[model samples]
Target chain A: MSVFITAFRAFGSQVNIWLDTATPAADGAPVLRQVPGWLADIEAALSRFRPDSELSRLNRRPREWADASETMLSSLDAALRAARITGGRVTPLVLRALVAAGYDRSFEEVARAGEAGDHATPVPASRWEAIQLDRAAGRVWLPDAIDLGGTAKGWAAQQIAQRLAAHGPALVDLGGDIVAQGKPWTVHVFDPFQPETPFAVVALHDRAIATSGTDYRRWGADRHHIIDPHTGAPARTDVVSATVIHPDAVLAEALAKAVVLQGSIAGLDWLAQHERAAGLVFDRIGRVLATENFQAYLTQTQTHTQKGA
Target chain B: MKMTSTKRFAVRTALVTSTTLATVIGAQALASIDEAARAQPIPAPTIAPADPVLQPTTATGQPVSAAVPNVVILRHAGEVSAPAINVEPQAPARPSASVVSGSAAPILPPNPVQIAPPAPVVQQVAAQPAPVTRSSR
Candidate 1:
């Protein structure tokens, strides 16, 4: 298979783009080159760590009408929708809570500093209804501090995949928040602790898959980025990692984060109840449990060799 | 299973209240409002709750359904056909992979890491497109 693969760092993680086509890499270079710009725009608009970012400006502003770009508006719309769908389990109004949890800076700086968290009590997220958007006016009224975090990343990936799909089959992976368009793409899920070893592999046909866990960026030994909106503390989930597959990348990412925070029982139940999505949840003890419908996407399940086989 | 509109609103309101308290207190010494709400036995619902005994616990030592009740009573859309993606493995290849074509046979490179006893194998299976039976609204 002739494919054009490109990788770059963006949004605090590696962004991998794969275009499956018989054409030369140059044929797809123009379309591929445009992806980074899209991601950079999203980062500048939604990143909480950037004091000059649109999200930061909104967070600092009074509860008055503020001007917003198309990117910020759409991202906020998706974030609020996710908050509603998850019953506020995944919220955009967690910026203060996130900073209170010691994630005030970029994840890179946090990891490099290795500073022990001050163990601040978590403030529950603000109400989703607090955000008012006027699309026609290109303005928004944010009644509380908000953070778009992974929602923007997933939305950006979806946009890139949709755009590139017009040219050819494309896969946009923004740090494991993925969208596969135009063709089926096989992806592997590994143990979060052992990222190199594969636990299961699934094929996505015009679908999206997102994995959220405490493995990626950690400040103190136990302090990771996935914060519970209810507790304001880092989520204490039995499942070390939760990967959700859905037709929408934005929805998949939101559900993945909600699943990790919900733990395995509610997580799996939520997935099972959601007819359009499936998921795999890995617990802290190496036990793997998947939703009933999740097997449909499992083209292969890589397992440790049987003893003496 | 579906929850009564009244019950759903109550749970959502409780959650919103808990959240408001957290934000108001600046996340410093915020009280456990969910715990307080859960401590008082909630009213009996028209529908039987999913057996709590069967629920799993988190590392925090709380039941998965802790505090919030009627979590299983979600609003689902009508059944949708699952996407026709082939999940069956076709090529013998290394486990550590980034991307593979859906239609073409993947080229297998040399397997580098070899452990004792049984080799780590990619167990293949036949593809099955199951209709999705549930969804979150």
Candidate 2:
């Protein structure tokens, strides 16, 4: 069987699509024509870019008992778990702040929300308690515009992976919120400052990797979208970038945020609790602080890019 | 009654066929390792690249290391993907390194050797070797 691989950069990053199919399809075929029609299904289910997406509907719904799909509901649950685990360091509640900070519109709109005076503080991070879900009725109510952008990406990646389960060997990188299934694939981690070079090239076969850093997409030299729920402002710490790996992408995404906000020791402690979660953190210093399990990931995907990425 | 030569030939063919099937089945087990090796994301770099070195440990809790030099992500070997771009490795010591607290920090008297501020040398923390494959097993 011939291998199928497709990659495209969207949502401000890159995504790699791979598969060892029974036979390869034409490259020009519309994304819809692909064997795994599941991609479209997922794009429809969670795309924040598409105007009619489920998330968009929820975002626009003006108070008529709106229904959330199983995907969103499941994600909410995961976000809640991560929030509890990290003691609220990570949360979906940063939505109000995100919008006020200028991400209220499309990602581009937010990008235009010029990095300004210290971000506007909102009522202490939207409390998850304010949101209500009627499990039996499949309904959700957000007292405030409690945003889920934090956990949605991770949720979407997981959903996409589940949709492609029957497919053979695959990797999905939704703007760096990556999730892989089955056989492993090579991934290169780069130094954000030196986009031209790669720091390490790792072989990841089955786990989800989500990186949280303040490089290009930041509000200012000191601000980025990765908001700190506790302070209602940009998160500050010595760790410049944090990559979290876990069987659960939702936790990984949320945890990455939590760790970057909490700093090193506490972040490692949270990372240690999950048997499947380990991480690598890079500081202002040119050193590598790896969790007990991070070294193994580097060994399997042993290729390193010549330049610092 | 004497058995004919053709009858003996039929028995031999049956034995041969049975043996061939066994060989194929046994070979399947041996191929699993190759399958695993091929299925894995093997290191592609012929020469190890520069490691993400850490700056010396500091008072505030910050990471001291820059990049993990050896980590092998594997099946069932924990999480493998990263959250964002790895930070550029700076030639400074990791503020949170063990050398600062793990009895590795060279002990100094209350007022000890203070060489006129060693001209801005990039102090980096060394990386330990632990490849990803070791943990998967």
Top candidate by DockQ: 1
List lDDT for all candidates, in order.
0.66, 0.54
Give the lDDT of residue B133 in candidate 2.
10
Candidate 1 stretches with Cα past 4 Å from truth are A116-119, A304-309, B1-137
Candidate 2 residue lDDT tens string, B63-126: 2332223332111111122222442333321122221221122211111112222222211113
What does candidate 2's lDDT look like per residue over A206-274, in tens digits? 788877754434544455666787667667765556778777877777777777787655566557666
State what share of the real interface contacts each candidate retains: 0.00, 0.00
List model 1 lDDT by residue over A1-309, tens digit each: 346666677777656787766455435666666777777887888888788988889889949999999988888899888888888888887877888888887766654555634667788876778789999999999878887874877888888887887678877888778888887777766544333345566778999888887645555556777888877888888766788999988889989889988887678877677879887776554445667566667674333322123
Best by TM-score: 1
Per-residue lDDT of B19-134 in model 1, one digit per residue for the tens?
99878786543456756777898787665443432333233334223222213211111111112233332233235422222222222222232222231122111332211111
lDDT of 2 at A132: 66
Q: Where in model 2 is the C-alpha error above 4 Å?
A: A9-12, A22-65, A110-119, A300-309, B1-137
Worst 10 residues of 2 chain B by lDDT: B128-137
